[model samples]
Target: MASRPSISLWFVMAADLATVVWMYTVGSWLDHTSKFTATSTLGGHHILVLVLAALAFATLAVLALITDGFTNTTPRLSLIKNLACILSVVALTGLVALILASLLSRIVFGRLRP
Candidate 1:
């Protein structure tokens, strides 16, 4: 028989799903809005988006690796890793959201730059 998932598991799943929704919605919104501006550090929207996605992936992966390595070893490390994981997930969610938003913009605004 299959086992039931715990509350924490459900929470995590819900949170992750919410993150995806937020990203897609925000992306759509930003794409339609005319007031948003790009900073020099982030460059133009297209390049900034790719950079954000890459950063999000890098941060989540690194934190996950650290958490995996510390699991079953130390309590302090476990707590720290968990915190880092949470933070990375949030950051990743935001960046990914931007990427998704940019996708909508690209589709509407044209993909090639003149």
Candidate 2:
């Protein structure tokens, strides 16, 4: 008989799905707003790249989590999981910083009108 998957696995799957949905939502919003000006378009493009990077890191984290879950005996899998976690944190940090900077620029420069 097959064993059931772990609860952690379910959580990871849900988080990944949420990330994809969020990426789609943000991309749609950016596409709509980017037509306002060259600066907004440029900022939107940068934001899209950061979002994609975060998603990629999140994917890597999920893969590592799954691999380590299945083969907990291996030291290599542990290393991969650790690396993925670290990279995911870094990606998230960069994404947040980029977003804050974009918002601040828009506010200070009065570009928020668009």
Candidate 3:
């Protein structure tokens, strides 16, 4: 008999999928908006949104690590472990991209001053 994938695996997969969709949406929005103006600054709200996205990615990466540790102990669960690894890499990649985008935005717009 074959064993079923755990609930936590499903939860992590769903959450990672949602987070990827959200990051893509925000990235698209940024690209669209950037084309309109040569010099534009991110407002406090925009910064807040970016920060939240980063946190989401970080949280997902941590969850993936924890899930992988707790659930992928048996040889039968190798597939799940691989999937978790991929999800963690994706999350980390998104986090890096977000950080790069923030740095580029700062360079382009200068520092946000009160």
Candidate 4:
């Protein structure tokens, strides 16, 4: 029987897609809404978001390296492989999220500034 994908993988994929969609929709809405104009700075939010994402990616990488599973293991099957796979998923997800968010923001808002 073919085994199903792991939960962490599903979470990572969902999170990546959700992050882009949420950011684009919310950013576009805030840009279009007049009431939020005085309360928030919609400009540069995408950059800020991507920066945060980069930080998160770095954090995950560091955690994976430091965690017990990765520490001086004697060639365990799941330890190194699992950590590496998880990190790969996160990295790819972050890249795709950033690209999609940027593209959608540009298309929807068109050089908006606060």
Candidate 5:
């Protein structure tokens, strides 16, 4: 029988999705707003880069989690797998930070930082 996802997993997925959306939306807003007094910092290329970067990082995090789910008896592979675990933690933490900052700014400043 197929098992349902744990509540923690559901929360993790929701937070990750929220962060990705926030990063892109805020990045785009900032890019556009910069045009008024400053040169457009994040133009189309920059937006693409930010989006791709977030996706890449998030993918790496997911892959890391999946890889850790395996159990094997190889030292070299274990080392690489451990590294993936570390990278995943870092990526997830960064994403969370970005989201928190965005949320706080919206709540306190009443603007989306654009």
Candidate 6:
């Protein structure tokens, strides 16, 4: 008998593709703005690719949460599910903190007092 693809796997692939597309499109647009600096040809491409790949992996991590068998059912042979939850929470919280910091930096760009 042939095995079918798990829902989690499908979502993971989808998420990865979405992340790459989103990162590529947005990064390209951001690159066009004069305000954004790309120090070198290699550095610019590397930065964009690195950011997109990280987002893609994060998408996979999140898919693990949404998959029914992975999150709803108890693991019979391991503690991977429990670990996933903990790691996912930490990753999400860190992302939130980073976003807040970015916003704060933008708002305070010209207001820091000596």
The TM-score leader among the candidates is 2
Per-prediction TM-score: 0.33, 0.38, 0.35, 0.29, 0.33, 0.31
What are the lDDT scores of the predictions, listed in order? 0.45, 0.49, 0.49, 0.46, 0.46, 0.44
Clashing pairs in 3: none
Candidate closer to the true structure by TM-score (higher is better), 4 or 6 = 6
Q: Which stretches in model 3 have alpha-carbon errors above 4 Å?
A: 1-21, 24-27, 35-72, 100-114
Q: Candidate 2 on 1-43: residue-level lDDT in tens?
A: 2233355544544544454465455645654564542232244
What is the per-residue lDDT of model 3 for residues 13-109, given as tens digits with 9 covering 90 to 100?
Answer: 5555555555455644553465432111132133333344355545545544755634434564455466555644445454455567778999999
Those runs of model 4 whose alpha carbons end farther than 4 Å from true positions after fitting are 1-44, 68-114
User: What 10-residue stretch in candidate 2 is worst by lDDT?
Assistant: 34-43
* TM-score-superior candidate, 2 or 5: 2
- Off by more than 4 A, model 6: 1-18, 32-43, 46-69, 72-102, 109-114
Per-residue CA lDDT of model 5 for 57-96, tens digit only, reads: 4654554465442332246545654464443344355445
Q: Can you list the residue pairs that collide in candidate 2?
A: none
lDDT of 6 by residue, 18-112 (tens): 53564455545434443332221122452444354455456445545554434343343125434433433432332344456667787979566
- The candidate 4 region of ten consecutive residues with least summed lDDT is 35-44
Provide backbone clash counts, one per model. Answer: 1, 0, 0, 0, 0, 0
Regions more than 4 Å wrong, model 2? 1-13, 28-71, 94-114
Model 1 Cα lDDT, one tens digit per residue, 91-111: 344445556777888998996
